[model samples]
Target: MAAGQKLYPRATVKKIVKAHSKCNVSKNVDVMIFLDYVLFMQTLVKEAAIDSKQAGERGISAKSIQKVAPDALSKFKG
Candidate 1:
């Protein structure tokens, strides 16, 4: 994805928020949620990549992701 491109679609994000929140949310709130989601995923992937390298893996694997997911989720949890 390009630097200025959004990883998640705005409509989909808004729909998800509405489904879970049961209310309309402001555009600014949607943007904030989107940023948070993107950052969390980026952090998770980066950490998984580092873990893979440290373990002598040639590339990131699901095992690396699984190992890092719980810690990443907790760190990014609200």
Candidate 2:
């Protein structure tokens, strides 16, 4: 939820995503590109609380992440 501070580290996110969706996250480009946003989402919810559908929502996708990333990144850390 903060700069250089992952609310959900990549590995953690990948694991949760895999568990919920039964889909490996390491193989996706968009998911990779949008991972930061997904991690950021954990700040709003509980740890590993975000589901794949939520992560894939238009508002949280790669296209929208850039718009919100800066704020999301700073919400918790600094």
Candidate 3:
């Protein structure tokens, strides 16, 4: 994805960006941090869905979330 496009939904993307926009950091460090953030968010959503299901609540189904929040679909996939 283009750098600009990669940071869609500026509000959410900013969390990753700002965390790395420090005074001193290697390009590699910044990239690694961003990747970690992405993976963390992805895992968080999936786990939340699973946890909700275990609790007998209507868990956030992967497919249903993808359909409702297409923009967030990337966060639900493997």
Candidate 4:
């Protein structure tokens, strides 16, 4: 996905950009951080969905998450 089309909302990106602007980091580094943040958030969403789904049953499994969020599974698989 494009950096601007990250899972995070526009407000979140604006906040992060504003926070990083105070530092002297290179634009390249900022972009890297932004990508990492997006991945982290996507992972969190996947994990949370799996956890919630499994909360009422046996332990969570990858297949369950795949059924719930196919794109999320594809990201990891790809």
Q: What is the C-alpha lDDT of each candidate?
A: 0.90, 0.56, 0.58, 0.62
* lDDT, candidate 4, at 13: 54
TM-score of each: 0.70, 0.28, 0.42, 0.40
Error of 2 at 4 (Å): 5.3
Deviation of model 1 at 51, angstroms: 0.6
Which candidate's lDDT is highest? 1
RMSD of 1: 4.0
Error (Å) of candidate 4 at residue 9 is 17
Candidate 2, residue 40: how far the Cα is off, in Å: 13
Ranking by TM-score: 1, 3, 4, 2
Question: lDDT tens string, model 2, 1-78?
Answer: 668885546666567777877865655534665756676676544322333245665334444545555666677452
Question: Alpha-carbon error at 7 in model 4, in Å?
Answer: 15
Stretch of 10 with least lDDT, candidate 4: 69-78
Error of 3 at 33 (Å): 1.3
Q: Which lDDT value does model 4 have at 71?
A: 58
Candidate 1 lDDT over residue span 1-78, tens digit each: 778997668888788889998988887777797689899999999999999999999999999999999999999877
Backbone clash total for model 2 is: 0
Model 2 regions more than 4 Å off: 1-7, 27-78
